[model samples]
Target: MYDRKDPYYKKAKQEGYKSRAAYKLKEIDKKYNLYHQNSRVLDAGCAPGGWSQVLLERVKNGVVVGVDILEMDSLNHPAFHFIHGDITEDETVERILEISDKYDLVVSDAAPNTSGQKLLDHVNSVELVQKIAELTRKVLKKKGTFLFKLFEGEDKDMVLKGLRKDFDMVKVVKPDATRKNSFEIYVICRGYKGEQG
Candidate 1:
């Protein structure tokens, strides 16, 4: 019951992409130069595999590890690895850490399920962003990059403030592929300072 004929949706189908969300990442990377030829990447909330596909194309020789609670069809590339489980769990974190010591880039497209209550939804989104930030701290290498989506609300500013403490550059980005009516924006942080004194 969605509009399969939407221009982006149609373009995704033609290009063999798993979802139209791929274009969002494409635009972000185009503007930010987030990818390198050999960048170890971690993708959280990566169901349906669009973002992982983009990472695979861009990272070429580096590792791409994607994790989510939902099942995803295997991406089937030597450089690509998928884990099925909640990313917040210790077991999942261990599994990911076992594969790579640290990541050069961490990207999360995670979003909480909205209940149509604006205040409650915003609160939940803020919590989810905090969780992702914690995970990024644990897994990302020093001077790495992070790109995660956050819904606009009062807490958005607070989240940005927290991120600025650790990253040399923290920016808010709304890609062209984002819906005009949506409240979502991506927080891009680079030059991670790491979790040590």
Candidate 2:
């Protein structure tokens, strides 16, 4: 039984965070030791700005550049930057590249609007993540990190095998904050060796 106001949702409201997704990022970072005080990050599909908020807090000096098709409410921090555009588009990628030569980390919580059919949803999610992976390769630094949300399905292993070629280590995680009924998982690709085109 998944409640609309689940524990994570209530905690986000009480803690002044934008969404429950913030906790997912927090728990993943705690376990993985992904970021540092100066890690440049690219936040793809970063609307509502929850992950970007965590990035800004964790990486005190390095910049956080968030890009999305939908407009995001401003986060008024010195190192935080936002782009109102689709991350998959060349124009948006150009804008992002203009922001920084390379990013130490790239994260996305993007997903296609679900139609309630699980298999179709999973396929769409895989395609979306693959597109984001391409964008990650273009922007991420050679020893960079990549993390993104993915809906589980049969083809996920194919995705993992592909990522393994690009990253030295790749792991899929389901954070405690994630609802038990939700099929979504997060993929962490670390030590990017730039193995892909």
Candidate 3:
């Protein structure tokens, strides 16, 4: 359970970010410089709009498109578009493709619904990662970047191995904003080598 009293949580509330997860992307971007002026971004599993909010901050002149099964209240930014749908569905992927030609950056904070059983949760998480990988292949521009949130488990190495084949560079990172006890880690993939439009 996340401590509501945590300083990052407090800072998020004070600064009007929808969730403390905002800082994770901020820190990631600080290190990788993922966003650029007028850059197009796809935020998968964006709920309550925190990652989208951070993307908005970076892409003032660009577009930030978000999609998730959960309903997210509008961020009220001109550059932001929210799609309320399950990203695992073909319709949802089609919707995303319809709106943007290709994304310069694709970021997913998506996690499978936990079943309390660790192994089951890991399997489900890996399934979601596969879906996200397919989506990335279709929509991510060549040489684009993908930042994926993943749980450390037996299947993680397999996932990373496949990602290495798709991207020029693939590495794991645990941002400072992530809970130290959490198994969650971010996989940053750069130079997408997927088919171009």
**Cα lDDT of all candidates, in order?**
0.90, 0.90, 0.91
- Runs of candidate 1 with Cα error greater than 4 angstroms are none
lDDT tens digits, residue span 1-197, model 2 = 33566988888888878878899999999999878989999998888888888888878889999988888789999999999987778899899999898999999999888888999999999999999999999999999999999999999999999899999999999999888888999999999996454
Instruction: Give the distance in Å from residue 86's predicted Cα in candidate 1 to where it truly belongs.
Output: 1.0
Give lDDT for model 2: 0.90
Which ten-residue region of model 3 has the weakest summed lDDT?
113-122
Regarding lDDT, does 2 or 3 come out ahead? 3
Structural similarity to truth (TM-score) of each candidate: 0.96, 0.95, 0.96
- Cα lDDT of model 1 by residue, 1-197, tens digit: 33686788898889988988899999999999997879999999998999898888868888999998899899999999888988778888888898898999999998888887778888998998898899889999999999999888999999999999999999999998887777889989999999966
Task: Tell me the tens digit of each residue's lDDT in model 3 across 1-197.
Answer: 66888999999999999989999999999999998978999999999889999998869887899998999788998999999999989899889988897999999999998877778888888999899988899999989999999877899999999899889999999999998777888999999997745
Model 3 RMSD, rounded to 1 decimal: 1.5
Pairs in steric clash, model 2: none
- 180 in model 1: Cα distance from truth in Å? 1.0
Best-first order by lDDT: 3, 1, 2
